[model samples]
Target: MFRTHSFVLLALMALLVLTQCTSAPDRSTKDPAEAVDVADQELSLTEEKSAGDWLQEADAAANEVEQHSALIRAANAFQNEHQWQQAAAILSQLAPKKITHHSQKYYRLAKARWAAEQKVWAKVIEELEDVATQFNQREFRVLSLQLLSQAAYQQQDYWQSLVWQVDAQRFAEQRNTDTVWSIARRIKQSELPQQRPNDLALAGWWRLVDYHHQAMTHPDSLTSFLNQWQQSFPNHDAATLVDIWLEPPLKPSESELEAEQAPPEPTLAVLLPLSGRYKQQGQAVRDGVIARTGEMKNLRVVFIDSEASDIESQQKQISELSPVGIIGPLLKDKVAAWSAQPITGIPQVYLNQIDDEAAQNSLTNVFFALSPESEAQQAAQKINQQFPSSKSALVITADGSSGRRMVDAFTSSWENEQAEQPTISYFSEREDMKTTVERSLGLTDSQQRIRAVKIAAGKIIVDEQERSRRDISAIYLPGNLQQTRLLKPFIDVSVSPFAEPIPVYASSATHELRNRLGDSDLNGIIFSDVPWLIESSGKNILLSQWLELRNGWGLSLARLTAMGYDSVSLIQRLEMMNRMPGLVWSGLSGELHIDNSVVQRKLIWATFSKGEITLAKEADNAGSRYR
Candidate 1:
């Protein structure tokens, strides 16, 4: 009887152990306090440091685990300093593991905040959405939804934000919460209309509203888009907003009338290297100046030969003339040498850009160039506008100083304004282009496929797989027509399985789309250039007249003509520009903005279509007298 009792006790004990082992571990549905405790233990610091100092600590950390922990601390430090981008960057590199639920929620919320500060609205939405939906904790979920509403608003999904805001308010009200109710009310009152439509329909309506506003600057593009919008949404309420933007007989502004009435200044001097290697360029300018200002009454223009050999003597002679204003001395070296001295009295316009910082900073004279940088920057801007979501750019340029400068300038503008870094690859010879391009586009992955085939069966066979890297969204080719022609075909083949051609943007150097046969090589390349070069508008008529005056008018010569014409016209209004501080001279070269005696030109954009260069529908930024 005693043995039987012992056996029964042993069985009961075993059954109890099994029951405990098989049962689910209790999960706290509230705050993830264990995770927070872990993070606190890892990240605890005795003394506070500056954001920069914390960043250095994070960088100098001993191992990946320490580095990640230090990065989190650094991000918190940056948040304290309100340097959100720095914080976002520090957090962006960290991939922490073995954290509890509370730590994950805290880290995600912190990341979302920093992302919002960095204007990375998409990231903000993504992080907040994950926290709100995945985590069932009431406090964090409510906070996450509230943050999502604000982030969505910043992302320009106004109606979506409003919906989130409303949802947040309802959730808060059910939980007797007060934090989100006021926010929801404010958003509804200020942002939403009386009639609340679905989010998508509201989004479409707001787009039309934005287009209506954008039409003020880009009427031609707006007109084309509105026509398409009308066709697509004839019965929609947004369609009614189109005709107001499309009405004809747009009135001219006072500035336009003033510019038309503005007479050319009297007794201007012209400096050109009229008898040397630069004579063709000089003569083109002379012809262009003569073509435009030659027929004008009461404008005494004296032509001076600025020979390169005796630049000092020529400049001295120019100074001795003591004319109203000066133009030219087109050589870069001469311009630099001349601008080093103080010419406080006469306002001059140099044809090429001033590279010397002291010269650029000290002189009251204006410097303009047939600037490649301007075209490159415009190309970058156009690419960003066209492909808002695709930020990564790959630049394919010639292996030289010019190409480097173009890439640097383009990258500077793109990274600073658009907030994305661009990859650069250079080619020295046509023979090396294929290899260089293949490496840049990541099409070398095909070699791996070939190797796999060889290892399996000694040759490529049917159903062999290859894939190109999809990270690169656009290509910037700052090379001439031939290089572009050569590089593009290689890129197309490299990215074969992906049918859509990656958008290719080029500078004014690719303006070689004259003949259909020659242009077949440049079918889809977009480039930025002076309107005088691409379009046969009224400006081209003037260029045509200038062209007829000169023989063998190449593209470079034609550009110089436009430069000379605008230079002459700009000096006439130089004082006006200086005084007003917001006036731009609409010249053949571009819309010219002269600030601090430095001339900047914004070129019109164009793209090759069916072997012809066509003016892009979007107008240049049309703020009056602004760059």
Candidate 2:
């Protein structure tokens, strides 16, 4: 058996980073390779193994006439062989299984019953602690704790899941501590109030700083999300990262209640990239921001090119003007640089994503509103929730930044959501994703046939890629609308286990992609998005604001009016929740949730067909899906 501290840490870290080990087999061998490295290996599950093995063997003895081993041994054999009925027969004969087996028997019996009921995960974990007893199988007991975490997670008991995760992490030391810290934070983030940008930001930071170390491509995908997150946590620095990319909200202190009594047109600062490759995007944000100010009485929105401003220079310029609040600095580097500068305390909301310093310091009074990678993760979570029974496959673009981020986020999130904290947070490119998953699930055979593909995806995977595609349920992830639209036709053509053509997606879908992949192409497919189109069933509490913006500003705004209106409405609500004083938002996206930790609903599901989106239901904000 490999007794290297590295392997044990490797398994634990994997659990912490990607949230792994929900349904692995109890191969029971000390060697990780021979036996599935399940959560049952934790010391907490183990104790004085009175007659654990004896009872198990006794259970196994019911069907096999020749084999004679301890009770636990018999039980394990029967369970491994999947002779549930026979195993139960022996367990039924045991007395007070827990105490008799030194607190091992009932636990294993629980496993037997759970397995018999087809609750594979629940059974394996429940049976492990008692069977592994501390004095006899300390490692196994610890593994049980880990497995318990996995079981809680898989069963959607996130709070309990985190408790177990915390317990198992205590034994992890030295090199394993990072994993423990990271996973602990991840569990905390999982408890986010909503999928909003603030929530997504917390989620993103965990996946990156502690795991992948960077955000996704096409950072614009999270624009609406960050805005929403900001609303939840108006003064939080988590919101500031994205706020750095955009402009700060009108400072309420400056625009005091006096404006309402004798309202003057409020001067809103619009920061954007007026002279850069991102000119189009900047213009989009500018137009959206301006279009947003239509209803506000005291508002005179000014557009400033964030690219033109140097860190210190822009600070001086903005302070001189004494604008209501400032926004923009769009790029991460730019935002971080700007954030590092000590300046006036006017509330600033950057359009860019969060910076390392800001996130580390947890700065106050800053609002961040966008984070593309986090948004994709939220989308992936929704996919998992929507189809808990179906596993996903990825058929992403071989190239492109958007493709890379989508493939990474979806693939990693799917596995993490499936496993009990596997270290799949490094699932960056398609190849990296393939290798990580194949190794975890033991898809050695599949790693082979797809040699060239895996190489292209960027990994020297020794596993069999061909066999992998054959083993798991998969999703086809095209990172862009174009990629998604282009890939839709090939679902039936590509090879994977799920007989039916599975859900297809990009992290986003613009009109262009929608126009291309009309109803037929989009049917049964899933995509992530903010609410742009209005449906009769959708409760438009922000309808008046949206109508006011459209009626006053030219209705020629991009599809972001819904988001802007929602953000304002959300902010108002948070302001109302003055007692909390932090961010507070919810019920804004399909399967998306947002809270103080984040701004936008983590995800909003959309389906496309014949150039139109067909989704209407938003996921409830109360579940672990947002967390």
lDDT of 1 by residue, 150-243 (tens): 7776544555665566556544636322332222222311244444345554444444444433443333365676776777557653344456
TM-score winner: 1
- Kindly give the stretch of ten consecutive residues in candidate 2 with the minimal lDDT sum: 209-218
Give candidate 2's TM-score: 0.48
lDDT of each: 0.64, 0.45
* Model 2 regions lying over 4 Å from their true place: 1-268, 275-277, 297-303, 320-324, 342-344, 354-360, 363-372, 390-392, 416-472, 493-499, 510-521, 533-601, 610-612, 616-627
Candidate 2 C-alpha lDDT tens digits along 440-513: 33445544546667677786555442433432343545454544545554444444453444445455543342
Clashes per model (N, Cα, C within 3 A): 1, 142
Badly placed stretches (over 4 Å) of model 1 are 1-265, 308-316, 416-420, 453-462, 513-518, 537-539, 579-581, 617-627
lDDT of 2 at 394: 41
What is the alpha-carbon lDDT for the whole of candidate 2?
Answer: 0.45
